[model samples]
Target: MAQMIAPVASLLFSVVLLLLGHGLQMTIVPLASLSLQFEGFMIGLAASAYFVGFVAGAIITPHVVVRAGHIRGFAVMVSSMSAAALLHPLVAEAEAWILFRFITGFCISGLYLIIESWLNEFADNSNRGLIMSVYIVVNYAAFTCGQLMATLTGPESFHLFAIASIIISVAVMPVAMTKAAQPAPIAIVKLDLRKVFKTSQAAIISALVIGMVVGSHISFAPIYAVQKGYDAMTQAPVFAAMLGLGGVISQWPLGRFSDRVDRRLVLMVISILGIFASISITLLDQADFLVFLIVGALIGAATQPAYSLAAAHGYDHASENGYVRMAAGLLVAFGLGSSIGPVVTSVLMQYVDIDALFLFPAVLLAVLVVYLAIRVMHKDAPVAENKDSFDFASTSATLGGVVSPELLNEEDRYVVVPDSWEPSEPEEDDTEEAASVEATDDADPTSADEAVAEDPLETKAKASA
Candidate 1:
């Protein structure tokens, strides 16, 4: 572990700083927009613009990395994001902020691709899981600490923006000075949506819905707190932190449980719980702030693990060679849904009550429940041998996360045999011996049944047929 940590420490530090800035910026933007007196719809639009750019960047950034080596690319992206952070305070209009948000999103996505790809390159199969786990922990911890920074200064002030920019700017120094060799350029994945859907319909749908729920919560929860008359600095961070805390608490247990059963059943259970939690939040009076926070945590615990479960389910059906492509497709689907979530919820919040934000997700969760329930009735549970072990998936996971199957345990590694590789034909004597055994089995129906029963793969194949 020490050997693994030594080389990648700089990269991990850079990620922590970058996510710190991101965490601060995420909360600051919505709160600042509210202070600027922008309408709810406008605030939501500005938030959604970031995701729009994120999706585009996911598609386009790999080429940028290919053109410029990882080190140079990393510097360029961090600088761009820093500049965008500063620009937010200079212009307070929704239109200007939306454009800034887009730029920030694009740069952040590019940066994530660079950093994650580097991490993947540095990690071998031996320690990939540890590295990935540390990376996720840093992400959550840094974001939580960054949220606390908002308490140091008011969101309406320029100081917070400056701090965010300064943090992002300093993040560049570690990577820029690191002695580690730059990773090879990453290839842009060719996403086939139909193939991904065919691989796991439940996974694709769950990704979309989970994206919507999480995106809206990240972008608008601050606004919701303010509307309810809670202190933005204190209560909002607690609210956001609770979500992260819930995710941290639930990811492993829920993920481990899914590995043992049908993942779709887990998804159904989570959706039902999420529906109840959302409904509880909607029905609870504003005065019950503590209960609201508790229920928010429950909602987070339930919804946050859906993406990982869904991704694992999809991986169960995908070949090893196709893992990266399928995961990328799921990320794109999630991004698309995230881009739309804030807009729809914002409009709902504007025309309806602020509670509509929670209600919208509840309805979506209910839809997921119904869909998964129906799908469960038709499809057989995956045989244990065929299922992939679950990994803790961050909502912020980029293409790099999907590309590195080394992060999984050795037994769970998806090995894609090359299409050109074929089993050697048996020698003439061996073929005759095999035929004799087959003939003997054919002579005894009971022996054939026993043979079939002993081989789970054959049994599964026959069952499917």
Candidate 2:
């Protein structure tokens, strides 16, 4: 327990630093882009660099960590991100910023890999749920705080960048100080494009749209708020509040209930409502708090689920052996969608105004609605009645919380390995637990806890969440 203290503290600080860095950088990026007289398309290009780089890094990160080892890989990546943040004001050119953003993305991927793999290692199977939930909460809290930091300072000078550096630099101390066992090297999972493509077209399209929506929301919402009559100071915090609170409030009922029902209808309903919210926000130029908060929350609740909706929808069409490959493919697709969303929306803002961003999502969502409507008509629509609610298990209580990958997609990422999880390599103890879990999963498909005893990570999840 004492040994676990430092690493857990480090993980907590990681949440804080990530959110703080994100909020500070996000507030700075767009304001700087406009000051430099960058076009919406160019701004899009710059923002896309992050996701583009992240995707590339994710592709290679697992292998690099395996070779260099966890601590070294984490140290290198965090330093890279920190260095990039520190360089932002110095290199201060649009192209330079884009290049820097790409580097930052590359660095953070290793950070994510290290942290997630660490959690995986720390948590045995029984407590995985609790551990993951706590992690998700911490993550959500950090992101919200990151969004809120835009109010603290602006891109007018180096103060924000300095603050970003402080956060990044501080992160290193926690990691370096921890005495926890460093994780073993891991092999990167190489995605098979040909196989994925042949399996589900929905994964491709859904990934694209999911990426577009989420990527733009994070990078541009501050500017979008500014255009909506908000000062830059007010912009970041409010947008953060919307996204941070929105998903937590809606996840439980929506995800849980959907488990027992058909999800296609839910997807259509969410998209339609999102379209309405996106379009409706344009009608409000008021200085009211309730309105923006309401709109932000609604938009968040309405759209955040799209990623899961699309992923689950695609998974419905896949074979049992295809879950992991499908997840990778969907992640790539979502990344691409995120990469493109900002530019297109930003360009739309040019012809009209900031209102274009909201309206732009509305239009794209409308297109999705039509497509799904057609699918529903053709009877090829995604069915939501299945219990794929693992990844989306957290309900309204998710607001200051984190959601775990295990809860989100267990069977896909880590299989239950009873033999590997024992305190001692007692093969007899392991086999007994395994036989027990198999019986549980067969009896209660929705119960993730039954399989917990057979896995060590599950035990860790309970402690953390």
TM-score of each candidate structure, all chains considered together: 0.85, 0.80
Q: Write the per-residue lDDT of candidate 1 for residues 260-305, one digit (tens) a residue.
A: 9999999889888988888887777666778878888898888777
Give all candidates' CA lDDT scores: 0.74, 0.64
Clash count per candidate:
0, 48
Over all chains combined, what TM-score does candidate 2 have? 0.80
In candidate 2, what are the lDDT values of residues 1-465, reduced to their tens digit? 444443476776765676567556765777767756777777888888887777777667666655666677777887788889888788767888889888876666556656766776666556545555666666667756766665776655688888887887777777677788764444334467677767766546655765676667766776777666666665645665686477666765666555655556677788899889888888887658677878888988887766666666556666665655665676677767767887787777777787877777787777777766776776654454534553543212112111223322234443222211222223555687787866766698645444443333321111000
Q: Give the lowest summed-lDDT range of ten residues in model 2.
A: 456-465
